[model samples]
Target chain A: MDFERLYRDHADTVFGYLAFKLQDRQIAEDLVQETFLAAYHGLEQLEGVQSPKAWLLAIAHNKLVDFLRRSRNQDLPLHPESLEAASSSAPSKLHMQEILEQLAEPERTIVYGLYVEGLTCRELGEILGLPEGTVKSKAHYARRRLYQWLQEGSAV
Target chain B: MSSEEYKELAWGLVYGTLSAEERELALHLVSQDPEFLEALKMELELKQRLAHLKRAMPEEAKERVYAAITGSRSQVLVTAVLKTVLETTLPRMLWPVLQILERSVFAGEQQ
Candidate 1:
């Protein structure tokens, strides 16, 4: 399945998503490996999937959710930097790096893939194994969520 | 266009997360709706800010990962085994021994 090419072409986005979503470098790296491994193995079985990008994303998303549920059940100690970012009055100065640093795990993956990776809705749908419709909807939802969070930054 | 819906579609479109049609529709809606136009500007700004956040994987790690995936460890192992076996083979070694024996017999007879 040329998994290496896939990993080379998409690994950064995948890792970025995982790192942001999982909030742990180690776990994110593990999930990235698992995601590629799943792609390596699952390529043979993915007949009905119309969008491969979305399909992969769906697998990755599920992996993320499973990891989150199994692990990270406890409320984490708040990062002081995020707390400080939240308190700063100059919201416009908020950089993408700061946003990424402050972002909780799931949102990080979705946002990084969409905005930073520059993946389209259809591409996301293919990666996640979702209908293009569903991918678009989720992306829309993700955007709104980001907007809400950005608004909350000033309040912090 | 509802402000909420505009907020959603606007960000999605600028982020490159929306389909081509949705982006067109969002733009159309923004043009027609006064409030949505304002929200669209904010969405655009947010997108610009987030655009700067894009990052690349570390170069060395990227190469290492590629090797891990595509490296032909088995091929190398098999080739090494074949070379070793050829060096140790019966007929291949016997050829050198026969050459040595031929030289001794011919050495004394050579005028």
Candidate 2:
């Protein structure tokens, strides 16, 4: 199924989502491997899939959820301060991270999928297992929150 | 439409999730309603800022994924070749040496 081409196309997307969510490049890289390996095994199923990027992202989202669950079970800090050192030092990236930190899950994932990954609401709905309407509402709320925050930040 | 619904439509417009009829409604509101116009403008700005967060996967990570998928096969091939060399060629090559050693041991014992 030309798995290499698939990976080449979506590796950044999968990694970006993981890195953004986990805030740890090393762990994100590990999960990227897991996601693609899982995809590799499921290559036959991918033939009829409509959007390969969204499909890969769904796998990535599940991997992240599993990792977070395992982490919670182990009592590991989900967002380690030390991991921030591993992220980009650019101001815009730091700012973006600061803004995203204010959001909770599903909203965070939706906003990221819609704005950053450029996925449609329907695609995000499929990935997040929520109805399209729910995704749109969450996106609306998240955008308003971000707008308010941006206005406040600018005021300051 | 309610302000909340317009807000949702504003976001839908920005994300390109709006249908033809919904998009028509959104644009009509944009022209007629100042609040909806402001909301649409904010959404566009927010979209741009959020898009700035997009990051490329590191080269090392990409290489690692490639290696992980291919490395297992390469490892198996290498193991099989080494096993064949050790089991077939090594034993065959060492048989004459073993015979020479055996004769030397017997000669020494007889002496």
Candidate 3:
């Protein structure tokens, strides 16, 4: 599937997503391997899928969640410290990061793509492999959840 | 319809995801409810803020992935381990069974 080129093109975006979500460079790198390995393995199945980037992001999301779960061994709250780097000196941005942590992974990715990648929801939908309508719904859920987190003091 | 009930689909609406019928309702709600409109605005803003956090992978990362991809070391390591396991463990596992069967056959012959 021209994997080297595909990896070259989207590795930054995938790494970006993992870095923010994981807040760990080492873990992010390891997971990137797993992500590519997974993508490499599943490339055949995903050939007809709408968005390989989004599909890879989904794998990354799962890997992140699994990593978090392993670390916490519970449905713990966001690693509060992870937000420190992103949020320091910018309270609103931190709030946004906190709010982001409250979102489900799909919602988070759609939000991340929308906010970070500057992709429209339709574009995000293409990447996420969801219908645009579904992608929008997730994006909205993410937004509302973030707002709720802020209003409720980043309640987990 | 109240914004609360509509939130299940709010992502779509915020992202202009409404179906023909739903769009009418969502637009009407947007006009009627300032709070709901504000929420949508915030969502968009939050998306922008989150976007600003993008990070580039450092150079070393590229090298690591490249090495892992091209070096063939891991493949070699895995194949070696598999061969060792098959050659050593497979015989060990079969030895007891083979011994028992040999004893049975030879003992019957002696009888």
Candidate No. with top lDDT: 2
- For A1-156, candidate 1 gives per-residue lDDT tens digits of 355556667777666666545445556666766776677667675566565555666677778877767666775442324223223345554554565556554345556666666666566655555677876666566666667766676413
The lDDT values for all models are 0.62, 0.81, 0.69
Give per-residue CA lDDT, model 2, range A34-73, as digits (tens): 9998998789989899999999999998998899899889
Model 1 CA deviation exceeding 4 Å by range = A65-156, B15-24, B29-31, B71-111
Question: Which interface RMSD values do the candidates have, in the order shown?
Answer: 4.4, 2.2, 3.7
Q: Is candidate 1 or candidate 3 better by DockQ?
A: 3
TM-score of each: 0.56, 0.72, 0.54
By the lDDT metric, which is better: model 2 or model 3? Answer: 2
Clash list (residue pairs), candidate 2? none
lDDT of 2: 0.81
Chain B TM-score, candidate 2? 0.56
The candidate scoring highest on TM-score is: 2
